[model samples]
Target: MELLKAQNIEKKFVNHLALDDVNVSIPENSIYGLLGPNGAGKTTLIRIINRITAPDKGEILLKGRPLQPEDVNIIGYLPEERGLYKKMKVGEQALYLARLKGLSKRDALKRLKYWFGKFEMEAWWDKKVEELSKGMAQKVQFVTTILHEPELLIFDEPFSGFDPINANMLKQEIIDLKKKGATIIFSTHNMASVEELCDHITLINQSRNILEGHIDDIRKKYKSNIYEISFNGEVEKLEKSLNQYYEIIDKTKVDGHSAVRIKLLHQTNENELLSLIIPAVEIISFKELIPSMNDIFIKVVNEYKN
Candidate 1:
């Protein structure tokens, strides 16, 4: 089921269009990546979804109904620009935010305590936000965002300040949230995080959606039919045999072994390629090379400019 959807969404600021005919459907209990370079309208779309701003020419649906201002209570948004009162104690600010989300004082305290313990942040509760490091403050903000168990969570650059260990910890928390029926819309430039955490993604460029789909499907769609082969063979003989059937993209030798990458031109199975090369080389491994999200991001963005 789709937890949230923005259909043909368009947003404008004065004379400039910030989002143009954008349509994205976020599935229930899945992490959807909202991606693009700076100025691509990623933040604009997120704001529209959060109802911080209205779309110029489109509609948004939450849980199969038209979205409303009241729906904000059900969403937990951690914006790219962090906001916390620097002079306020971390615990105090957390409790205040939780209450604004409609949690009672007692329940808020319980949830805060649990999250503080979970994140190993008990010692910092009484400390002022101004005293905390960027990463520590981020942890406090994260706890408040998820304390309400919101049905929809929007995280814009959620991993910005953390070290690898804490980032991994947050990643696991996000996965856990998905398992527990929370749908998340994550916006980040980190393609590595997208590959690791996102199930579906929408890529925007110059305020237009250029690509959208399941990660694996998109990867497959953009595949160049490239393969890497490793084997031990007389270099010249192996090259000659492979040249007969495949376009050799690269060939390198290391540690008494040779590796070659080939892009198949004609419809030929790996077995067929193997059959031709077996007598000439000892095959060690053969694997297809799929383009990574980083590659896809650059490719799509470049195409948009052209």
Candidate 2:
């Protein structure tokens, strides 16, 4: 079921249309990727959903009802711009933020200790925020953001400053959060992360939503009928056996096997291609070459531009 829905959301800023008729439905306990290039109004939409700014038109529904001011209590938001009191000690700042999120002092301390220990940050608890590195500060902020265990979490560029190890750690935490029934709206320019973590995505471009669907379905829709075949046969013989419906896009040697990428033309199906090639070569493996999210993003954005 959809936990959050935005219908016909529109936002304007002094002659700039930040969001135009943008709509998205985020399912319960799933990670929804809010994607777009820089200045494509993704931040504007996120802000509107967080009630940081009001929309000029349309409505936002949380759990099938009109969103209210109190709804923010159930939402955890980590904006792209990180902020913390530099002079305050790490533990002190975390406690302050947790209190603002309505957590009891004892409960907040318990949770903060657990998170800090898990993140190997026990030593930095008493240190000032200014003394920590960017990645270290980010860890503290992340812990505080989800300290109250909000049902809905919005993370904008969550992996921005972390190294590969820390990023992977954060990724696993996100997956764990989903398993624990938290619906996440992850906003990032990282397509690889989107593919790895997002169950569904809405691609916004030029202040409008251009694509929206499940990751697998979107990849299937954007596929180009390309197939990769690894067979033990001569490249020339394989090339000659195919009819005009097949076009060889790439050829390489994989572990002494001739691997070739072929594009099916004129709506030629896989069965037909296999039927023709089976008699001529020994088929070791065959698989469709699905386009990645990065490819689809570029293709869709360029098509919309044209």
Taking the tens digit of each residue's C-alpha lDDT, what string does model 1 give over 82-125? 98999999999999999999899999999999999989999998
Per-residue lDDT of 235 in model 1: 68
Span of 10 residues, lowest total lDDT, candidate 1: 236-245
In candidate 2, where is summed lDDT lowest over 10 consecutive residues?
69-78
* Model 1 segments more than 4 A misplaced: 243-245
Write down the lDDT of every candidate, Cα atoms only: 0.92, 0.94
| Model 2 stretches astray by more than 4 angstroms | none
RMSD for each of the candidates: 1.3, 1.3
lDDT of 1 at 7: 95
Error of 2 at 52 (Å): 0.8
